[model samples]
Target chain A: MQETPRIRMLLGLADDALIHGHRLSEWTGHAPTLEEELALANIALDLIGQARALYQATGLPEDDLAYLRDPHQFRNVLIAELPNGDFAFTIARLLLVATAADLAWRDAATSDDSDLPAIAAMARNEIAYHIRHAADWLIRLGDGTEESHRRSQNALDALWPYTGELTVGIDRSAWLGAIEAVLERATLTHPADGWMQGGGRDGRHTEHLGHLLAEMQILPRSHPGATW
Target chain B: MTNTPLWEVFVRARNGLAHKHVGSVHAADATMALQAARDVYTRRGEGLSLWVVPSNAIVASDPTDREMLFEPTGSKIYRHPTFYEVPEEVGHM
Candidate 1:
């Protein structure tokens, strides 16, 4: 059976939020400080909340959608699944994705579709907080102690390549034009010099995503019908 | 201990009547200081606004100095009501 355009759109939204949320959750007990640990957990919750709304919009049970699918069935772009390397790397990813998601939602808030716009509005508010939290870290790490500064720069460089997939601007279903248009407007007009790195959309992900997915999907994949 | 700087956090929640001291977190600098404060104190939608100030910026008196600092007028009888009568109609005290 064919899925509706709205369903397809909703699935993409849910997939992105779920995968990212899962990735963030891995940092729960591993952060360098108690404060950072809590911050990462809170962001994870925000993404999960976004995923729940998108799943509801698509008429799918959020739990089933998150846990029932095999790896290949997932459509989250590689950036969402890339491993969290270090505190600096995680902060870099947070800044990049939060900025990207904020831009995407800014356009989505004005989507031609009724329900998606409302969902996007709520997501936009949450994204604002995410952006603020990550941006502060970005600035501190970017301009802090010599070691921190080096780590932040390295993190930005490492994560830069995966960010390309975030603004692919194409949807298989033609119904997503509004979202695409919004993305174009929201994407950073001129990313700071030398920050444009590409190649995450065509499924040629970095080695990191494979390992991350293996560990992340194991619990659900091993016991397909199990509930926690 | 001497090398570490202290920070004080003030949070204003959405439903709160005033900005109150929530808790504090330590960081190497002012920017990280504020970020740490947010992460430490506002995990559950507990803050709409936040302020972080270096603890050293505040001036405080030692508790040991309390008597000399505040005892000058303690014995002024006029400062306390020695006796008073409440009318029966004054109601609950």
Candidate 2:
């Protein structure tokens, strides 16, 4: 049987959340401050929760989708799987992705598909905070001391090229406008439009994804059928 | 930085109730304090409302003065509501 567009879309959303949530979880003990550690962990939990809901909607066990799939089989955006280089880099990626997610889920909340609207409704709320938190950090880091300002600008420049891939089918203007507003408030100059990268949606990913999956799937693959 | 101020967090578990102290978190400002409080103290839906007050803003009495502040009230039994018994029919009182 062929996969329905609905299932494919749901899988994409689930993969995005799961991969990004895994990245965010890496900051658990490593955030700059104790408060930030908790904040990141909470956001990670929210994303993972969204992924689980999205997966469950497809009538598949979330663990199987998360832990059993090979890297090439996953449907997340390349940006979601990118290595978090530094605090500023993570914030930059997070701000971009959260903005897209906030907009995506906002529309999904009204989806006609089964379970998606309800799942999206709850996810929309969590992603709203994720946007707020990321935007807050963006502003603070972008407008803060010289070192912070430089790092924030550099992070944006490095990550900006990957953002074009995020708006392939979705309405790009709204996401662009929202991001521009945040950038303006942060006193940061937007990077010039340049070459864009794609292919994560097509099952093509960067080298980092393989390493991420290796760590994420190690236990599950090593001990198949093992129950906690 | 370590010098960031700490804010005490309080949560009102439900409507028509007072906020009770839950914990504290370090924040550079009140907005971040509230955000941290929400992230740290309310993850389990344990609050209907939140209050974040800077630790420095609080004027707590010295613990050493507890005897002078509270012990004297203990012997003032007349101030107690249990001093007088209600009739058996007044079950609630």
Candidate 3:
């Protein structure tokens, strides 16, 4: 399909939500504690819900778009597709992505040319909670014991390169301020700026996205007519 | 799971109602505990507001003394307001 800019932007956001939500859902039976499991699952559900809205705005059934997309067709930033390393790594990535998402959705909600203001509006509310949840976890992990602090710092350093790709529908400075404030409170040093990565929006992604898509689309592709 | 403390969660369903003890969550601190409470208890919109406290901080009555304390109050008919014979004009009182 030859998508207009608006529809493309919507699909990109939808991809981000769906892929990141899937990553979070991977923690379903594996989180360290029951409460943490519930928390991650709840946030995952919220992201997937946002994905559904954006997919609908593109005039396609959400399941079809989500379950049938090829790796090259997905437009989620590489950051969202990265493996959840450790608990600290998960929190660090979520803090960055949720902050960026909050900014992106806030801008999309008020844009005069937006076709679905309501989708962005609801997304803003959901991302607000996601930002807080991720920030709190990051702070505790970063400022915590020797092992946790080291892990948090390492995750931030590793994930810093992909933060550049999040500016698709938002300003870097606006979102960076929020991320830096949380880093300051977390007592974690922000990684010095260096080479930045991009191209996901144009369908170029890391090897991780391919593996992720295969795992995500397997059931749907394998059993085309399967139903509950 | 790294020896995180447990917290007791209370949720108020609406304004003008007291927060009722709903459940518990494990968190490293109060903020995480409160956020966890929101995720664990209010996902279905069951709460209007929430409070989370360290589970150890709560001073619960000893269950072993239940027979000596609550059982005494249960049989005290004098504590019953129904003992009073009021005229119909007294209304709810």
Candidate 4:
């Protein structure tokens, strides 16, 4: 079957949101404090919401797109599936992704495409909070206790490999150039080329994704059409 | 490893309005308390101003004393001017 370019692009977005939301949800009941737990949960919910909107627009049920797919079918980059290593690591990951996602969505919200702009606008406000919160924690953790500083730096180093594919914008997508320009304006430093990793978008996932899907999909797959 | 105390949240929705009780959250300190309150309470833009008080520092009136403390204000009928008749041109009165 010939895949439409729109479906493929939308799949990339939904997959990214699904994988990252699953990763963030791992911090639930285990964050450094009650406030942090709530924050992570709220961010996860927003990502899930974005994924649902994108998936539904792409002509698929969000549940089927999120839970029914096999691990090999997922197009999310490898970084989103990596395990949450520590509090600092989690914050660091959030800092990086939220900053980039925030930039990308800002451009998306202003795109020539009608529906895409509206969806991106709605997502931008929530993503702003996610970026600020994560960046605040990054500064605190990076400058705080000896342990915290070390952990965050290590997290950045570890996650540095997957940064490249995130910026590999789809050539046919009109918003790519604008989004890249906005992200560049932020002046956030990504690691050098030798350090940048790959394989998430190619459907080559990390070892972590299987376990992540098994757990995230269990309830929905088992229930099959259950709704609140 | 950090044991930050809980904080009480109060929100002021508009400039002329009084700050009212909201809820509480545990934070590393007061600054973080304010940030957390903003994230948790104002995510939907519910507030224009916020105050974070350490949970331990708040003093309270007894719940059992509610009638004695609040009833007196309600019983003062003369506090309101129900009997007054206003002239037609006195619009606000």
Clashes of each: 0, 0, 0, 2
How would you encode candidate 2's per-residue C-alpha lDDT over A1-228 as one tens digit per residue?
235787788888999999999999999788999888889999999999999999999887778888998888888999999988899889889999999988788778787888988998888888889989889888988988899889999988988888887876677899889999998988887777789988888789999999999999999899998898
Considering TM-score, where higher is better, how would the candidates rank from best to worst? 2, 3, 4, 1
**Candidate 4, superposed: residue stretches over 4 Å from native:** A170-192, B14-16, B29-31, B43-45, B53-93
What is the lDDT, from 0 to 100, of the residue A154 in candidate 1?
78
lDDT tens digits by residue: candidate 1, A57-145:
77667666776655555667777877778887787677667767776776788889757798887888788877777766666666567
Q: Record all residue pairs in model 2 with backbone atoms less than 3 Å apart, i.e. clashing.
A: none
Stretches of candidate 2 exceeding 4 Å from the true structure: none
Top-TM-score candidate index: 2
Candidate 4 on A112-215: residue-level lDDT in tens? 75467877877888788887777667767766777777776777668776767876663313323433343344323334446567777667887889999999
- Best-first order by lDDT: 2, 3, 4, 1
As a whole number from 0 to 100, the lDDT of residue A15 in candidate 1 is 77
DockQ of 2: 0.78
DockQ of each: 0.46, 0.78, 0.78, 0.38
The DockQ-derived docking category for candidate 3 is: medium
Q: Which stretches of candidate 1 lie over 4 Å from their true place?
A: A1-3, A170-228, B1-4, B13-16, B66-93
* Model 2: per-residue Cα lDDT over B1-93, one tens digit each: 898899999999999999999989998888888988998888899999999998989998999999999999988888878877789998884
Q: What are the per-residue Cα lDDT tens digits for candidate 3 across A71-151?
A: 888888999999998989998989899998887777777878546678887888888888888888888888888998999
| Ten residues in sequence with the least summed lDDT for candidate 1 chain A | A182-191
